[model samples]
Target: MACIQVVIWLFVVQCSAVCFANYVLKEEPEYKHTLLKRILMEENFESLESKINNLTQRVEALEKENALLKHAPVAFLAELTKSVTSQNQIILFDSVKLNLGNAYFNVHGNFIAPVSGLYQFSVTACAATNHYIVLELIVNARVVGKVLTGDTGYNECSSNSFLVQLSTGDDVYVQHKTAGDYLLANPAAGFPTFSGVLLNVI
Candidate 1:
């Protein structure tokens, strides 16, 4: 009887040890799997967030480029209506052949810059027979270019062009550098004209 009781007790002890070992093994793997899954989910979320931020920045840059393109084309051409003779006088190119942006005013004979940018300007002048004319291209009260036309044996024309940087609201026009008898109006010698175009935005 004593031997049988001891055998029963030993069997019970072995079964309890095996059950405890199986439970620990199963629970440890489930915990590790859960931890790994959570870490992977967090990494994926961070990667998606980074990609979204990069796309948003690119979209903003494209919007700015589109706005610049919308306001890019700016140009004008004007011709003198009458002769210029006095010193320090504003040469009025009253006949506007083309005015894309309305920046040139025929009344005041000046171009007010609508936007800040680099600009290219041109001026054509003519002199009557036996007379001479000196013209200066002025920008905001500063002389940017000059031209002189004289009787080189007959009526003739002279032209000048320059590139300059202008700010919004800056004034540009042609003025007589010196007093003269008269400026000729002939089609053979090119018409007295003033023209400008925006080259680039700064």
Candidate 2:
């Protein structure tokens, strides 16, 4: 009877060990599969995030470039070197202070519009001790505006500004109304200056 009990106990112990090993085997494979899935998902997510960041940066760069290109870049600041005597003579702003995009404001003192747009023009004149003259801002030889400077014995100064629409290839220059009257020259060269800038592209 004792021998029979020993055999039965051995069989029960063996079956218990087999059951524990089967449980361990089943749980380990499930854990490994879950871990592998998580790792793959994390890698994929990181790759996608990197691509998204790159795309976002490119989009921002393109937006900045497009904003700059919205308006045609053109600007000029010129000053006359000497006094003009003739009535319809073009006051050459010989100094190249700032000429952007090209020589739009050339030695002939004409701000030729390269694009149809609104532009702001300015002219400052200094009065001499014995001269009086009217300077007109003429577009294509038509008197659009004028600024008068006369000797007041106080080193008088006169300046005029205008905002006008100019088409492509339109000519803009200053002209004296009378031939005999003269515009006073400034030794500093900054007092008698004519400048124009495009306000906005049309």
Candidate 3:
């Protein structure tokens, strides 16, 4: 009976030991799996943050581009008008006539260099007879190119386009052959007008 009791006690101890070992092994593997999952989640979060930053930068850039496009046309027209004279003067047009010789007319402005690129320039004029209007691209007080429009009737208008390479300190202007009130008479309200010249950088 004593030997049988001892044998039973040993069997119980062995079973308990085996069960504990199995539990330890299973729990360790679960802990390791949990650690690995955490690491992967951290990596994914970092990747997501990077992508968000890039998207934010792109959005900001697009906003700036949109603003520039919105203001471009107005800036272009203002530049053209400002280039005509150094002082601030009101532009007047009545019945297709531009009162360019009004006592307020002043044609003096400093030319600053524009961006270095191919620039397109255009001039439109209105006259009663086929008279000549000379458009000039002036750089540093020198005429780079002189464009002449042939005689146009008082009720006629003409446009000329030119490709010019402009640097800083470039200027442009239109001179009429006749001094008498040169007006552009056309259906357009500002017909005998100098819409002023435009320079499109390409």
Candidate 4:
């Protein structure tokens, strides 16, 4: 009888041990899967953060470029009209004063250096008489060089171009020669008589 009892007890203990082991194995598998899911989530968050930083940097760069484009190359235009006694001359368009007889315009303006790169200048003039329109690139009230439009006649146009390295705070203007009765006219609207020059910076 005792032997029988001992065998039954041993069987019961073995079964109990098997049940506990199965439970432990099942629980361990679920914990390992949970840990793997957490690791993947962290990796995904890191990737998203990197993308946001890159996009922010690109956006800042574009904004700066747009600002630069808006502030480059100032332009001005002048028109000529008829007058009663003296033919209207658009003298002194900007920083430059026009002397019709001398055929030169004196230029003066504040020069704010745009960048540390090469710069180009262009000027165009239209008149009603046969004369040469000369363009002088002046730096700080001094003439660096001069370009002549060769031949220009009445109702004709002339232009000149120049390239120079400019630093910040440089001033420039155009001077022209005046002949006959030439007078500076207001560029405002409804003046009847008009004559002037156009200045462009690039």
The most accurate candidate by lDDT is 1
Clashing pairs in 2: none
Tens digits of per-residue lDDT for model 1 on 56-152? 9999877766655778578999988677666768888888889988999999999999988889999988997789887889999999888888885
At residue 77, candidate 3 shows an lDDT of 19
Cα lDDT tens digits for candidate 3, 86-148? 112222322222222121122332223343334554455444465444444444555555444
TM-scores, all candidates, are 0.65, 0.61, 0.35, 0.35
Clashes of 4: 32
Model 4 lDDT tens row, 1-202: 9999999999999999988767766879986687678877878787878999999999988876665555544333323332212332223444233322222223322233434334555555443344434444565666665544333334444556666665544554444433333222233432211122212222
Best TM-score among the predictions, by candidate number: 1
Native-referenced Cα lDDT, model 3? 0.45
Answer with 3 or 4, whichever has the higher lDDT.
Answer: 4
For each candidate, what is the lDDT?
Answer: 0.84, 0.77, 0.45, 0.46
Candidate 3 or 2, higher TM-score:
2
Off by over 4 Å in 4: 1-91, 94-111, 114-116, 150-153, 177-202
RMSD of each: 13.5, 14.3, 14.3, 15.2
Task: Encode model 2's per-residue lDDT on 8-45: one tens digit a residue.
Answer: 99999999998986777687998668767887787878
Order of candidate numbers by TM-score, starting with the best:
1, 2, 3, 4
- Positional deviation of 95 in candidate 1, in angstroms? 0.4
The TM-score of predicted model 3 comes to 0.35
Ranking by lDDT: 1, 2, 4, 3
